[model samples]
Target: MAHDGSDRSGRTEIDHSRRRVLAASGIAIAGSVGVAGCLGDDAGDPFDDYGPQAAALESTAVSWDDLGDLEGELTIYSGRTRDQIDPLFEMIEDEYPDFTVEVDQDGNEDQLNSLREEGENSPADIFYTQSSGALAALKSDGLARELPEDITGAVDDDWSDPDGEWTGASGRVRAIMYDTDEFDGADLPEDIFAYAEDEQFQDVISTRPNSGTFRSFITAMIEMEGEDETRGWVSDMVNQQNATLYSSGSQQAEEVAYGDQDIGLGNQYYAGRILNEDPDATLDVAFTSDDPGCLFNVSGVAILSASDRPNLAAEFTRHILAAEGQEFFVDVNGEYPVIDGVEYVGDLPTVDEINPPSFDLNALGDVEAASDLLREEGMTV
Candidate 1:
């Protein structure tokens, strides 16, 4: 919305009182996230101090002791695949030899349900998810714990939890991907909703209504335009009769790039991957300009309340948020780094410039409402 890095999405801030209310009311939500394997044994100082107080305060600052003597195994559950985060696992293993991190990656909802069912016996030391929605679900169920104050000290208050249950890691913006041959750049819809109503986009647009991406977009609509408006938009999308509902953003982007569809809604990375694979492909990204439909989603890390290794788990979490670990995204995976100063090699838009309409809810944190909306609209998985 603005280049100042302030959340320009116009999202209304939830006062501490409301957050306490949610914490008390125990409303549940669900979604995806991932974890990585452990590596070598040379442990570094967790609190080596990056620099001045201001610099430390600007990042997810954490306290640390030598990981050399810490003896523990921290289990993590994630929705991100191994291929995407293996390097991170190796880094942790090599850097913190005394602490081993075990990773399990699966779909967002599946991982959350597993944690809930496991209860106190859950092996999960940390929980990582694709969106805030999943964390919200755990929070409602009394499964999430507050993050360490020092670890969260540097992140902007709005970007992190008041109680530190979860915070945005790296962010990806939602955008429209289209076959440039079929739809000229000039013909792209200015807003996301209009794409559903456009006659040419009829049957030509593909979507994943039940997936996390769609849920995030719909949640944003509900937050920005209210429930009625959001529902109306969904109805219009269905009326187009041209929309094909896939299971995920990557698949939808694949369909659009392969000429199976003219346009699709997806995270920038899906489209980026496609272009990287086929430079000759006719696919191109069209970020919404009207009310900017772009949505920012992240993979979050948090310590599970049931973990036996809270201190070690917290240290691992600190490592992930550290400058070196955050920059691993550029060298290892193509995904954006969660830490602020790291550079994102992908051609995605900066989070601040996206100018998406901010609403009262965290897009990922409102899964139940979104799930109900999708079901009410007859959009089953």
Candidate 2:
């Protein structure tokens, strides 16, 4: 199989439909908020700007105003891309003029290392990351503070830490993104391991071995199937089947849409993004029932234990779990809301409907072991 190296430079343009939906949801308060510049031509009434897609979504039960006033200075170490997270922070800033935020944007590994080095003196009040493994690592290292019941109770038990150290804000599932033009959804196997063992999929599936998401998937596999079995699967894919490599999940989804490959292993949101761009893109996402391929992971948030503004940090964390924050993730990032009653965009099933493998999310923190296995298999440099 040929290697099409990672394209880390390009950023996907924010879907306009998301903006319109957010506007109607009252999370985007265009004219009143500083985001008026980013959102062109406000329709005066936020509801007036929304299209049919926005109209279908029910209004969140708890609005930003319902969260009440938040006043303080909080710094965040965010692993999510600026394009994705900045708008949400901007909304928070606009809503609470007295509350200001400073975001340090970088890769998850880099941010985690920096926090460890800084120890008790780290300036970050919150650590918001795209990987559950990273959040679990923080909890294990004693860098995260226990969250309040109100915050942790908002999401399901599977989405939050058992000890209350961190809570998932939004959900993503591992999926097989395939071109509908080439194959029927029914033709795809429900077991993720089948992609390696089956001959029909050889040299036709693309994967991002270097992504943090992929690493977490491997970690879960190790916990469930043990290292040796996981190692054999990785070895077969890398050394025998010759799986193609891409730099990002989004790119893998795009290539599948273009018929460059029959299928690609990536998160569900990547396909949502492509469909958001063009609903007729000929790409659809499939899941592996009760398998690690359908791992339900989250982009989560945690209050740092060393923060001077613990009260303020807790409030901010709560805000992320609130209806407005949950809707922002669904509308803007195409992610599933971790909280109840917030509808996910597109025709995708709910988190419960996905029925992912049963495992402790915190157990996925052994990403070092996963990375080492990938290196041993020569899947990554």
Candidate 3:
């Protein structure tokens, strides 16, 4: 998790001649038309359309019986909503009566900052967050403990930290959400870069460039394709002038589903959430090439370095990695399970088959460059 030391504010203010100036300047700004103010994104409802998981969906990850019960009360500082995590926490309490959890949920980024302020005396035993960026930041701050191989080894190498500080519980993929009423399935293109020239989708697709997911997507795009090319695509979209930015991904997806736009850029899980609220809704996910826009991000857990109950914290992580825990995330929260063997309850392509680009999820912790690109284009996050 190395910082590039590049400052986003250190740019020469440009004189624009419509779209041509940025072409020559080699740095495009999001047009003022559709962007949010470009500073930051508002917190979203992470538990939208959440429900209890299925009765019999078993997990392929470690079993509670295999791990054994060794828990007391543990306090969790969660960067996800209570509804997003309650079902799983309730499951742990019901199965192991002695293990109860007190969860305090807040925005991931804000909570990360708070933890840093608290330092070694932080009361949290477990830190569960919605983005790997927060997890990486914690690890980088020396606030996370290295997990034993028994916990870290349950999931694949890519799903956990390389230095073994955190483990991904569930995953989400970036997607193109299309309005079924506006375009037939074939009209939607899977490749986003190729979609730039698409007539129907031009000037209509929306995203929250300021949102955490959107920033991560753009950062990963920068990693997959160099800065200039990534900037070029955004410039093209900006030149179209109809490419819009939203306050949140779900709102962007809803606008597409409501027919205000033909397509939107958001998490694939968001479409699933819409379907949960309205099964007959016309919203559908149109995936892009496995590069930037379609990259996967995880909501992960880690035992804090300042825990008062380390063993209980680690056991809770085991419960989350178990089959039932994985099922809750896939079925209830509409996420891709990182632990193998849990059946995903949606129409999404299998996680392993998505063919997303290879990049360190940790490296994408800083989305400053991507936000700067959007801001320069005159767009907000």
Among the numbered candidates, top TM-score falls to 2
Q: Estimate each model's TM-score.
A: 0.76, 0.84, 0.78
How well is each residue in 1-381 modelled by candidate 3, as lDDT tens digits?
A: 001223233222222232243223433221121212111012111212111111111224544444446446777888776556766777667767656677777778778888999998887878998878778888989999887566677667776798889988899888778888877766666677865556666777777666666777778888888899888878777676458878866677778777578777788887877786687888777677667878888889988888756655665687687666776776667789887555576765667657666668888667678878988976674
Off by over 4 Å in 2: 1-61
Q: Give the top-scoring candidate (lDDT).
A: 2
Residues 11-105, candidate 1, lDDT per residue (tens digit)? Answer: 22212332233224432100111122221222221322211211122343222221113345767888765545655666555545565666776
* Greater-lDDT candidate between 1 and 3: 3
lDDT by residue for model 2 (159-192), tens: 8899989988888999999889887998889998
Which consecutive 10 residues in model 3 have the weakest lDDT in total?
37-46
Please list the C-alpha lDDT of all candidates, in the order they appear: 0.61, 0.76, 0.69
Q: In order, what is each prediction's RMSD in angstroms?
A: 12.8, 9.4, 17.4
